[model samples]
Target: MKYDWVLFDADETLFHFDSFGGMKLMFERFGVNFTRDDYDAYQLVNKPLWVDYQDGKITADELKIIRFEGWATKLGITPFELNSAFLEAMADICTLLPGAKELLDALSGNAKLGIITNGFTELQAIRLERTGLSDYFEHVVISEEVGVAKPDLGIFDHAHQLMGLPCKTKILMVGDNPHSDVLGGINFGIETCWLNTQGVQTPAGIHPHYEVNSLEQLRMTLFA
Candidate 1:
């Protein structure tokens, strides 16, 4: 392996983060039928909160509560209660992406592994444990715990602290989001790989050291 430490982003990078499925399951418990239209409406609130979170404009707690506020009011529940239910539902449905286990197995002995995610603390631990991937990582830095989100150097710095301050050049970040994963890694002076599964155009002025369409491709590239 080219890097001594490999950091991964949790959602969509390693795990299948099916927000719609999670929400549907969560709402089902409350006797609400979550439809595609409901999901679209949820995303309208949720997506911008994620961007705001990555940009450090809002906190994870704020984002979590605010995104569910409308639903909470309608359901006669607290936002925190609704948010917790959603996370639990997400963890229940969590599954690794295709070839995620193979890729991790290939890289395990060669590099120190870590997860630096903007995902909530409520889901990360349980998801990893339930998916049987908990032991693969040396660190799991959550923005919620750090009070700082990705695309911000503080979270990366916190991760480095947990890593005992490894060499910057020997660290590589792999994630699905170009902005939070690639751009943040670039800004932090580390190598990065963007998992461009959708084959979307690379955003302006952001670049990754490598790009792959799937974890299988990444495994091939790394172990070739």
Candidate 2:
């Protein structure tokens, strides 16, 4: 393998995070029928909070509680409770993206594997365990635990320390987000690969060591 450590992002990069589907499922238990319009409206609130969370403007707890506040009030529950239910529903529905398991299996013994995700602490353990991918990673670094999100050097520094300070050249960070995953890794002096499954245009002022459309393509690139 070209890299000693292969660090992955949890959502989108490896796992299929169907947020709308998860929300719909969660709301079903509460006797609420969630619709696409409802999801669209929810995103108006939720998306900005995530951007703020990533930018260090708002905290994970703040993002979680605030996003669910409207729904919580309507349901006669706390925002934290709604957040927990949403995360639980997400974990229950979690699945590996196409070719993710195969790609990970191919690299399992050759490289040290780990995850560095901006996702919350609530979903990590259960999602990994349910998917039987918990043993594949050396550590799953969560921004919630680190008190810093991606695109910030602090979180990458924390991940590097947990990795026993591997050479920057020997580490690879892979994720779908250009700003957080690609730019952050580049700034932190490590190689990065953008998993551009959407085939979207790369934004200006950011670059990655590699870019692939799918995990199968990434596996091929690694061994090519």
Q: Report every candidate's CA lDDT.
A: 0.94, 0.96
- Candidate 2 matches the true fold with a TM-score of 0.99
Task: Show the colliding residue pairs in model 1.
Answer: none
- Per-residue alpha-carbon lDDT of candidate 1 for residues 1-224, written as tens digits (9 for 90 to 100): 78899999999999999989999999999999999999999899899989998888998889979999999999999999999999999999999999999999999999999999999898998999999999999999999999998889999999998999989999999999999999999999999999999999999999899999999999899878
| TM per candidate | 0.98, 0.99
Per-residue alpha-carbon lDDT of model 2 for 122-215, expressed as tens digits? 9999999898898999989999999999999999999999999999999999999999999999999999999999999999988899999999
Error of 2 at 78 (Å): 0.2
**Which candidate's TM-score is highest?**
2
Residue 41 error for model 2, in Å?
Answer: 0.6
Model 2 poorest 10 in a row by lDDT: 202-211
lDDT of 1 at 189: 92
Measured by C-alpha RMSD in angstroms, how accurate is candidate 2? 0.6
